[model samples]
Target: MPTPIPANARNPLRTFRFRIRMNTSAAGQYVAGVRTVSGLSVHVSPFEVWEGGNNLHRYAQPHKVNWEPIVMEQGLALDDTLERWALAVLEFARTGKAPGEAVKRDVFIDLWDGFAHPTEVPAPGPEARIRSFYVHNAWVSKYHALPKLDAMAGEVALLSLELTHEGWEPVPKPPASKPASPA
Candidate 1:
């Protein structure tokens, strides 16, 4: 018989308990206070192949792969990293000069185990991290600087950025270290 999973591991990781890290600079800073994240997905197109003798059946094979644009929304804050990045891309388009490394960045989304209270999600340490998605070669495609301003509304001001990325993959877990032998 197969071994059963432990009780503690049965629960799914909560979506709210996560962190977004953008490779904005060589220092590698984390984008703080992100309210929402979406569009972490990929689609593979399939091509149909039919053998000359086998008219009865057709085989479908994977072809081109496409990655969806990731959208992130956050309450407007003092930090201007998102704005600056978007402006850089705009400048590139205006001047016809390549933005080079300044516009493109790798984004990391880390999902943490939500064992704590909803109001008290702790910062994920290495062990607390359940999984991480690595978004490669992402550049800002759209920037919504301000939402529909309404003085009568009670909602917070939100700024959103959409990023087009080449692809994304799950970050691989590190190898386990071996215990030292008795001397």
Candidate 2:
């Protein structure tokens, strides 16, 4: 009989342990207080072709590819990065003039394996990053600055931004280094 895995064994990386960096500044700072992120997806339309001689079937091939708009939400806070980006997009739409390179940004999402580190290892940082996705040339397509307020309810005000991007791809893992020989 096969040995059963222990209940205390580490589980796969959790979705809650990810970080989103807007890449808007030189430091590529993480977007603060992000509560949820969604719409990381891609689709490829199929082109169907039928052969005159064969009544058997129609061949389908890959056609145009599309990336879904990524949506990010967070509780309203003092940090105005999201708001600023949304304003830039609005300005472009109103003026009919591109805001140079300000309208577009490359966003990076990093996922970490929270339970992968050993006790001796330092706290999770860049080394703990297991996967990363790069959303290229993204621009804010929609922004919701304020959530409906109710006097009777107590809840944090949330804001959301929807970003349309050219496409997204997984960041390639760096090549492993070879062990050095003893001098």
Candidate 3:
């Protein structure tokens, strides 16, 4: 038989939906019109820190943190802003010369509730700001704008970008602002 559920076990603040935003200081601005982003992938490199003295079992521990490249997918549009950005990174990767400057940037993911009137992250109310995850020092690792046409030519074009980053951490909540005193 299954055990009965507890009333206090459920959490009202739990969220399940989110929106993604990518910003790059290296590009001097954030990439606009991004449709979707491959969610965060983090790994902790496991290694043995302590050795056993003729013992059958050895203790192991996590040493380094590694983050996988995030893939940003978007519907190909008329604008070539993202294309140019990707090309710039490619130029640097291919040759020493870059068509334009390339810089590392941070990627942020904001959680949201579907019940909200306007479905967007960073909403005015604190309820909309469920949780924020951010990755630091990220750059484009690969870009694909190739089209596969085989009776699917009528389908919308899409662009896939792989962003390699160092590591990610949860964004801390902002402190409450104090009211100003009368002059």
lDDT of 2 at 132: 87
lDDT of 3 by residue, 47-122 (tens): 8655546566667788888787788776677446567768878787788685654546566767654443333334
lDDT tens per residue, model 2, 20-101: 8877678788777788889999999999998999978999999999899999988787467788889889989999887644
Task: State TM-scores per candidate.
Answer: 0.81, 0.81, 0.69
Q: RMSD (Cα, Å) of candidate 3?
A: 6.5
Mind sharing the TM-score for model 3?
A: 0.69
Q: Write the per-residue lDDT of candidate 1 for residues 19-63, one digit (tens) a residue.
A: 788876775777777889999988999999999999999999999
Q: Give the backbone clash total of model 2.
A: 0
TM-score (C-alpha, index-matched) for candidate 1: 0.81
lDDT of 3 at 118: 36
- Cα miss at 157, model 1 (Å)? 1.1
- Cα lDDT, all candidates: 0.81, 0.82, 0.66
Please give the lDDT score at residue 94 for candidate 2.
97
lDDT of predicted model 3: 0.66
Rank the candidate models, highest TM-score first: 1, 2, 3
Q: What is the C-alpha RMSD of each candidate to the true structure, in Å?
A: 4.4, 4.0, 6.5
